[model samples]
Target chain A: MKKLYSTKYFKNKNNKHAEASLKKRLRFKKNKKKRNKIQNARTKPQKRVVNNKNKHFDYFKSKAPGNFSFLTHPIEVIEFISTLKSHFDKKRKVFILMNKIKSIDYSAIVILLSIMVKFKEKKVEFNGDFPSDDNINNILIASGFFQTLFKISFKTRERYNIGTHNAIHTHAWKDVDAELGANIMDNVSKMILGHKVIYKGLQRSLVELMQNSFNHATPTKEGEKHWWLSVNVNEKQKIASFSFIDYGVGIFESLNSKKEGSKFFNWKILMNLFSSENNADVLRKILNGDLHKTVTGKHYRGKGLPGIKEAMDRNLISNLHIITNNVFANVGLDKYELLPNNFEGTFVYFEINAQTSSTPWTELQ
Target chain B: MDRITVKIARDFSRTPGPRYIKEGKWSGEQFRTEKFYSIFDDAIKNDKIVVVDLDGTLGYGTSFLEEIFGGLIREHHLDYNQILNHLELISNEEPYLMTDIFAYLKDAHEESLVDNH
Candidate 1:
């Protein structure tokens, strides 16, 4: 009976299966050929406008240099850096064109710091020129990137004031086209290549912390707009630093309403609420479920600090020091060291490793 | 021998949504709760290769994972170091696990694979 079945049903079934497989294979082959043609067509030189209207709008819309306009939000900043990564081929000179920028906010500055750090980590050369103005310089200084992140010469400042500012003031800016158009790409290329990935995690953490300030700490007036930022990178040392500052109402005033009736509104209580292990764990538990709900209601998802703690544990980041409302929490060696300090709003600094040569943790361990 | 696979499970049920008050009382919608873990557990039992994409599967908080994976690890009596090593391996490949509890599941899966081997 088995032999008879095999001779009759099995042979017919096998033939049918073979025919179906052959048809499927032929279809796949045709699709593969079409796909190849499409892919090759994509590689052909395509006419792309170097200066489209939308690109022009993007160029003039905001301040800062490079693609800082891409750093409006923290998530956007992260996505931008992740995408910019593909541009780092490590062969050709990479340029971050920031000539069209006018001014920048602190949030944009911190995002820039993260990008610089990531670039340094990848060992890719970064080159760019940004507006050299007093306000821009002051914003950079306040964000903690003036001396810590980049080297700016006083002569360059004087030149900018005399050449750029005076040019705008006296309508002579158009006269020094040669000076303005000097080979900045080379200097930028060298600077970015030599740039170190320092204070990247700190910058990211500070951005988040500062945004939290805007969200829950600072009070917004009818039409008042404020910005905050920081950036630093040390490619060789694999260290980075970042900080942010906002001009809005500080933490004390923001939490003053809660302080009016509760004992948990004092600086010490606030610090504990922000850094205590129990509170952090509880917040972590709540955040583990759903972020949207945790962020929307009064039951605030207080996991930012805890998330920072977890990041420190997982990443190459070494330390996180936060100073808010005269209270401080310094996390190092997987422990929290609380201290009293005199400061306003929020300030955070952290250290991270940024060596492209080193094996990633997953691959190494 | 079947290739070892890791699976991730989420509890979308406990994920709170916009709250509503029915008759001036707080109530929740028919949110997906047990389906995530049930799918994962069923997949594991059936011995189908599983690779839990943490970022794709879970987001935000990880308490649900702490309970699920933590319980699995405890039940299996997996070596802590070995579990962590496996977790580090998966996390390095997919950093999303660093923010979610899927890392714990990866760790548990490694231990189970070692035991089976």
Candidate 2:
């Protein structure tokens, strides 16, 4: 034979076994180091990079949609705000791109202000650019967003003659300010009614709202968190729109944690048996005085919501809408909708127009 | 029986605030301690009917109303029936507030009964 492992290698069975052993030895000799490297890699632990630079390395960038409004684009606006929760939680820098925003409504403006206030509270770093569109930028300035956030004052631009133009007045308080609330009501009354008239229902509603915020807005005892209020008077439409916001554990969350195993809990169970216990349904029951009736032992508690509802019923205010947690309710129309995103706070918006009645200043004292 | 009148807007606050004094200025608790309670005590001792004028204020919050009326029974331990007998609430601007005050008194009385038992 020419060689032991030649073309006739398979011709002899004994020779073939010897050839197979030789081939195995040659293959193991060629790749022996590669096998050792893989084994060593499996047993070694990787090092973690703990540089301070790496802590702030990653940024969560969020883009604003064109119509950022709870009234116009509710789902998108809510979802956009929800994205910042992570930025707050991780204490990461967030870059919000607002170049694409065409228009923003008062509701969205209030929400954005509220979010920035929270970001300041948490010491979370966030950055944003003004909308390239000058009109939208003017709106941001006029609504006091830029002044409140960056402390940069711009020459107040001529207001847009849009539907229901806003002359925005904003306020923030840590405790109940009945005087401030009354002053606001007085100003709003003069703006709409052309005279000073105390709207009793509206004043009561404001006090109740402030009390709720002071008492239940936070998990802390009381007065630790600030409640924000914005009033936008539209002299053209003769409608004064008010927005009240508090960043707290929302209504449902507050009740659930605070009233565990109480009569409110029993009522909640009964409510669940009768209907789906979605946030909207629970909110409807609360507004309807169903849940309030269950907590009668305290007697002073649980009247804020129903009292607001009663004000609406008596035609003291119109277009009463509330968004808290994951529910959006148009209480005036009896429409309670379950939103896909959570608001993380309570927002109450109502309007008082020319037709809205008031207690004349002359009628009292 | 003798009669006395306490106009809340005149004697207490024209802008009544929240429930407790710790909550804010001009709170119902402050009003009760500084103004209303003394007058009420005198009325009870002297067999006088107390008339409370509930108007001429910016408005009355539920907590303010509750703390004043309900607190008579809850805080001071005054009999609710006697309070109802002697107390006269005049709310001309907001008539429904009178109804609400009466209800709060009844609720506080019921709550006190449960607590005692």
Candidate 3:
């Protein structure tokens, strides 16, 4: 009877001890899991993608500066590209935050619009913010930024021509064909310049410009090579100015690449030439067709620049200025000056004065 | 002397704007220059006069003109004057085109003689 009572008491005591030990082990496991999760959260790289598949892109994070009036602040244009490229490396849905833009200019609007087109070309989903400043917004819209975004046709109250909307807007080109070139020229002549005639040489020069972009722009992807063209008309001033921008390998760099491709020059000796002449001087030679004798070895080479010069010389275009790389060439003044910072590609701006032309737009068909 | 006329619109390309050679389209570097050269070369071999009509077509590119007119000198080894003698250019719509082609041919002649290659 005594042995049975003692065995029951010990069994009850053992069961209580076993239960406490099981709870202690479960508590330790829970604490370890919590610690592991907190440590993982601390060490892990922030998720680039969110649930909505949209990535948060900060403008200033890449440390690249945005440009305003890219002509005056050319380096900022390049810097802006660098920033955009860094974000592009992520390859997620990009939300371009332009609210951090420290400076803004009309030319900058053209460049941003071109980038947007690039994103569209790649099928990369993206949207951007307008500057918080009301003045900048007004300037961009007045300069035809939104109209271009919507792909508004180029015409006016005068002509109901399909694809002819009377506005200063951004445009892109791929080939040197007549359909695009002729239509663009007609719009510039009738709607902008108030001329009834399309200047054939000027139209041809535009094609050549696109050709240069194709031949030398040298983008990462072949189709990614794009040129941005904006034509603004000042009717009261009787002047029209055209801006063309291409983001690609610059002229000098392209010449160097071509030289290397042809195996024409010994880099050891050519390195000395780089020290002596800056890109601006090289640009002058290209415009004058002198680069043909030195580098390209082909007669047809350098013909495009001369073609554009011919248009300028013939009074079809006037007061021409080309900024490419770190060089600026003012053909009218016969001046070539090196800029403070380099532009990775090309920016060409020129004015057409109505009074300078002996040929009346009305007389042209 | 049979005066052969190559109407760009009817014979070569109605909208010869692009210059893609590999695609075999009506580009300057593709159909236009190649066909124009063949006809001109054939006409010249038989001592026939050649007339090129530049109307009824979407204009021309500098490369197109240079390749056809200047290519005679650079690629075929014909002198600039010889091509001008054999081939006559007529453009009612763009009268200055003939002169421009002549200048391009002359420039190509002077540049090709240098033997830069």
Candidate 2 per-residue lDDT over residues A1-365, each given as its tens digit: 65654655455776778799999988997688786665556522211112222343565677877888776677887788778877787787776778789887778777777677667656666656667688888767777776656643322211111122236766777888888767677778888888998887777788889898888888557887778777788777888888888888888877766655465565565554455467788788788787665454343233687888888888887899998988999888898998877877788888888888788785434
Candidate 2 chain A: 10-residue stretch with minimal lDDT: A155-164
Pairs with backbone N, CA or C atoms under 3 Å apart (clashes), candidate 3: A153-A165, A154-A163, A154-A164, A154-A165, A155-A164, A155-A165, A155-A166, A196-A361
Give the C-alpha interface root-mean-square deviation per candidate: 19.0, 2.5, 5.7
Report the error of model 3 at residue A179, Å: 1.6
Per-residue lDDT, model 3, residue A315, is 71
DockQ-derived CAPRI band for the predicted complex in model 2? acceptable
Residue-level lDDT of model 3, residues A1-365, one tens digit each, is 56764797887987899999999999999999997786567522222222112333432233324446665666666667656655565554555554456666546766766765665455555555555566766666676554544453322121111112455555665544455555555666664456555455555566667667766788333434667777666667766667778888887766556544453345324434667776777677767766654544444332577767766776767877787888878887888888776777877777666644433332211
lDDT of 2: 0.76
| CA-lDDT, candidates in order | 0.38, 0.76, 0.62
Compare the candidates by DockQ and give the number of the best one.
Answer: 2
Ordered by DockQ, highest first, the candidates read 2, 3, 1
Q: How well is candidate 1 docked (DockQ)?
A: 0.01
TM-score, cand. 3 = 0.67
Best by lDDT: 2
lDDT of 1 by residue, A101-214 (tens): 565553455445444443444455544443445566555544444342343322211111111220111001101111211122122222334532222223224323433443
How far is A72's C-alpha from truth in model 1 (Å)?
29
Best by TM-score: 2
TM-score of 1: 0.31
